[model samples]
Target: MITDPARLLVYESDGLTAYRTAPRAVVLPATTEEVVAVMKLLHAEGIPVVPRGAGTGLSGGALASPGAVILGTSRMNRILSLDPENRLARLQPGVVNTRLSDAARPHGLYYAPDPSSQTTCTIGGNVAENSGGPHCLKYGVTSRYVVGLTVVLADGEVVVLGGAGADPY
Candidate 1:
């Protein structure tokens, strides 16, 4: 937990830079288990939780509330699994968008929807905001490449939405 105002200032806004709000605290959880634990503790105390992914969102979606806690996904970045045959990759939300393409390039694959900020934007933020870039006009957006998600609901329940082999259609 980061209570230092100097550090909390970093979580005040995102790439947009138009809107800003200082959060009460900043919590960087490195794992899903840690995220869940923080959420449970915050839920019991009635503290609001704001999920942030790299702070690269151009839409100010990552802006923290007046007294909410910012849960950054930077430390959670890890490529959990990769299935080249199935063209699937299970990654933590903190994984940079370009990192995925870089890793999959060795397998002769690449993630579509190349946002201009892919190098710095997190996949989780892209998925959450349905972000896209120049390639979107031809290859669609992040939603198309996203096969699954593991989300923590408002009630602090951890749920896996889809799987590597799960059919979206």
Candidate 2:
């Protein structure tokens, strides 16, 4: 991996024209195990984790703190499964918001919550921000479309938010 100060700065500063403090390092994990391992390392070292995708965040959520490790999920942008029958998709967090609709288009289905940055924003970021869009008034925000999530907690344990049962909210 090409890990350098300038590279990390570019990745962190993509969304904002003016930003501060690049990252100490950047990692692109391809699998759940890899991501969890990185998280565990950060936790052990007391280094902060900044989860990012597409760098489209208008706010500074993706911005890196000093010496923090920037975890860009862009490389993990893959649709694991799309079940039109179930009206859901098991997706990696880095998948673009609009990409879901594109993937769903073949089945005449679409993921709701088409944010203004749908083409650029990532699902994980949307989940974190509870991001809303123009159609949200009628449809709902990304929170509504999400039936479940595989979350990594602060302790570095992987947990599923929802199971085979219904939404279970």
Candidate 3:
């Protein structure tokens, strides 16, 4: 957690520079459990939480609301698992979209989204925006490739949605 104004200023905006707002604080949780813990505290205190992923969002989605807490996902980057046979990958929301394809190359698999900012934009941001790129003409956006998600609700409840199998219903 960071309360220093100077440090917090760094997260005032995402890639989009037109809009900006300094967060009351910035928290970079390294794991989902840590994120949940932080959310629990924030919820109890009634502080708003803004989730950020690499700050590569072109829409200013990473920009914090006034007095809100910026929850940066950069430190949480990690490719947790890959199943080539099932054509699925499970990962931390902070994982860069391109990195997933790079790691899966050896398995003759690749995540299809190719947003211009793929090298830096994170999966979480992609999901949040339902982003698309050049390849989207052929493969569509993040939602098409995302088979499952582990979401931490505002109240700090963890919910797993979907699965590796085709029927992620």
Candidate with the greatest lDDT versus the true structure: 1
The predicted structure with the larger lDDT, 2 or 3, is 3
lDDT of 2 by residue, 58-140 (tens): 77888888778888888888999888887768899899988889999999998787777888888988887788888889987
What number of backbone clashes does candidate 3 have, counting pairs of residues 3 or more apart or in separate chains? 0
What residue runs in model 2 are displaced by over 4 Å at the alpha carbon?
A: none
Q: Residues 1-169, candidate 3, lDDT per residue (tens digit)?
A: 8999888877998888888899999999999999999999999999999999888778888888878999988888888888788888888988998899899999998888888898988998899988899979887887888777889999999998877755632
Sort every candidate by TM-score, greatest first.
1, 3, 2
**Alpha carbon lDDT of each predicted model:** 0.88, 0.80, 0.87
RMSDs, each prediction?
1.0, 1.8, 1.4
Residue 46 deviation, candidate 3, in Å? 0.5
CA lDDT, candidate 1, residue 162? 76
Off by over 4 Å in 1: none
RMSD of 2: 1.8
Sort order, lDDT high to low: 1, 3, 2
Q: Report the CA-based lDDT of candidate 2 relative to the real structure.
A: 0.80
Which TM-score value belongs to model 2?
A: 0.90
